[model samples]
Target chain A: MLRSQFHIELNNMHVELDKMCHLVIEAIDRCVEAFQNHDLELAQEIIRNDKAINDVERSVESKCLSLILKQQPVASDLRDVSTALKVVTDLERIGDQSADIAELILEMDEKDSYLMIEHIPSMARVAIEMVTSALSAFHEHDIQKANEVKKHDREMDQLFEEVKLELVQIVKENKDHVDLAIQFLMIAKYFERIGDHVVNICEWVEFNQTGKVNDTRLI
Target chain B: MENKIVAKNVNLHYGSKHALKNVSLDIKENAITAFIGPSGCGKSTFLKTLNRMNDYVENCKIEGTILLDGEDVYDEKVDTTVLRKKVGMVFQQPNPFPMSIYDNIAYGPRIHGIKNKRELDRIVEESLKAAALYDEVSDRLHTSALGLSGGQQQRLCIARALAVQPDVILLDEPTSALDPISTLKIEELLLDLKDKYTIAIVTHNMQQASRIADYTAFFLVGEMIEYGQTKDIFSIPKDKRTEDYITGRFG
Candidate 1:
């Protein structure tokens, strides 16, 4: 086969993979947004909307399998597709975690419980932003952005720590609000974890682009 | 095993297309060497060069020297017919002769001017035994070669090659048409035969190459990208292309 044909096939695969990653990131963003707004209806909608992400995951995985069995791609094209499949798996898990957080938010009846911490909303925002940027970096094959996202995971960890400490103080000050504070803390922890997972996805992308798994600490 | 065939800065071309680019490798005597790569990467073409099988194809040309026992096999005075007798080949498909099994094994010795009946019988027995098919087919030596099963047919072809008393054997995907048991038998035979004859095989199966090869050479787009011990090439190939290919990251 011609080299041009090979490149075209690989480029097409990468494009479709990027689109799937975008859908997963969008789902995660919506779930986090719904929880932060204390909108039970929106949170429930996000929780029920998980099937789209699942569909995308299955499609991307099968595409990678077909590429392997049919094209018998070699060298970098093989690494790229294999890593894309793994990264989508991480994205799927992130989507699941987002849905889980959304379900928890819908179960919590208290609306003002989220106002305890100024950092919790920022934490969610930063986490989603990290996820979105990491995926973008993967689509662009930007190693610098991948490394930057890994470094940003530390900020998400700091936000998680600060929010957890603040929530503990709030629970101690008023034992009546302990349950609500704990629930919000748990939500913050999930978002922080989502950030870490996205960073992992970025690391896989970097490895696909350049066959070296970056040694970045998760923090 | 000593180096029996050495290719230094060898380049091959088919008309305008370059098939091998400065490929340099040593085929050791009494050892099995595997050539592994995706199709159209010149692994099979490179294997054919060892015995000058490419001479049959028009417009195929080779540069540099291929030395067999310190003598240039491609020299003007070196007859390709005699070189082929020294380096026998087994192809992907079992191409057994239409004659009887005994005749198939005896054909090579007869072509080389061995006419004694006692010598022919000995050569057939020894060759079949060398291919690990002597006991299975010793009673059926008079049977037609085409009547055997696929695996048995492949073994028969191997025995036919062995009967020629070639110093080097070239197998190009020899077990590709056989079942798992047959593949294992051929692989085992290759391992055992390496102690007596120098062997070079080209295979698409990485697992098979890792399993049976002592030295492995990885090719990509007509270039010999990596050559080393089989374990090192499989576990940690020095080249990124080789690692990617072997690890199922690509073809």
Candidate 2:
């Protein structure tokens, strides 16, 4: 019942949430690196690390529940706890998408040439930055950085379109490798999805800061 | 808000001690409004002002308008008896009268002069049903109310309040003394009763307020710190002091 200890528990919740964020960030970085370098060993590592991401997300959620039951937080304190609750959901999905990308990378046969292989890496880099920047914004309460994540999302979307266009060109011209080009498109789609999850984390940060969720509009 | 009772800039004093300070809010009709705060923060004092329950305190002076149905309840011409009849109250302790259940419920209508045997019997049944106590105690109508469980006794108190057919009910910590299941039943009973009567309850149980109340007001140091829909109050309290109190940060 000590105020200091209640706050300590609250701080512990934040630390756990940050830990989950870092885990997902690592998954994104390594998943893309394994894909770019054609490193099947690293791809398998990311796929295995998916279970760890789920465990951290589950642990953060348990911590949130404990804080609510023990401390009964309200106002901004309550907001922070609930926001952390939501943040982990998107983080878990980002983790899953990374693993999905890695799984696809695992199944794809080695190819000397693939459509948009260079472009997909660019998308992955932007997506990784999005996740990394959004987590930093949330940890530091930086609205400007969160906004920048939203702005950068457009680039991720455009790169996805470019990959799709190049896939279509490959399918039209050299139908022999069309299936591998389709896998590249799927990877680009996963990277775009990772960007979307980062945007969601930014929106959750806005909710934590102002207690206003962007799920509705008042106009 | 379709308010049933309105307090406007209400102030109360216990001799020189300012007990309630410039409090104002509406108790919406057919909805439960909960007043929550720590001890001596004026939540209970303000709840009493709604039904003029504070009039019993010696040297208590009230200086504001409380209107029920657009009529100033504190007007010189307003009869306190009729006022009390229109606004019944349930207390913290399950203070069932040391009498049979039938008599405990019939006592209110008898004092109001409904002496016909069948009429009083019907009123007893109706009030008991309204309080969700009829099924449990109908067979033991003649048994002493003090013999019932603590939860039943509290519901009997609610039945006694309902017996008067009051338009508004003021409860002071009605479930603070009961177990979790009993507390849940009381909360369910309150939610059901709010459809027929406007309710204002003062409670220290934060979850109880959130569960049943449509609106909530947070009191602190004789001041109304925050007032809003229960969802807003719990999820996003505006004042730092209100936040502290709810978040268990305020001592």
Best by lDDT: 2
Residue B175, model 2: Cα distance from true site in angstroms: 0.8
What tens-digit string does per-residue lDDT give for candidate 2 at A80-173?
8888899999999999999999899888876633334557768978988899889999998877778888898999999889888878887888
- RMSD list, candidates in order: 5.9, 2.8
Candidate 1 residue lDDT tens string, A1-219: 244555566677667777777777777777766765778787777777677777778877877887777666544566677787788788888878888888788778755556558798888778878888888788778989888888888999998889888888888888998878877877887888888788888888677665667753111
Q: Give me candidate 1's TM-score against the actual structure.
A: 0.73
Error of 1 at A83 (Å): 2.3
For every model in order, the fraction of real contacts preserved is 0.00, 0.56
| Model 2 quality (TM-score) | 0.91
lDDT of 1: 0.84
lDDT (Cα, tens digit) per residue for candidate 1, span B1-251: 68999999989999999999999999888988999998999999999988889998899999988999999988999988789899999999999999999999999899999999999999999999999999999889999999998999999989999999999999999999999999999999999999889999999887788889999999998999999888667544679888667755563
Query: TM-score winner among the candidates?
Result: 2
- Chain B TM-scores of the candidates: 0.98, 0.99
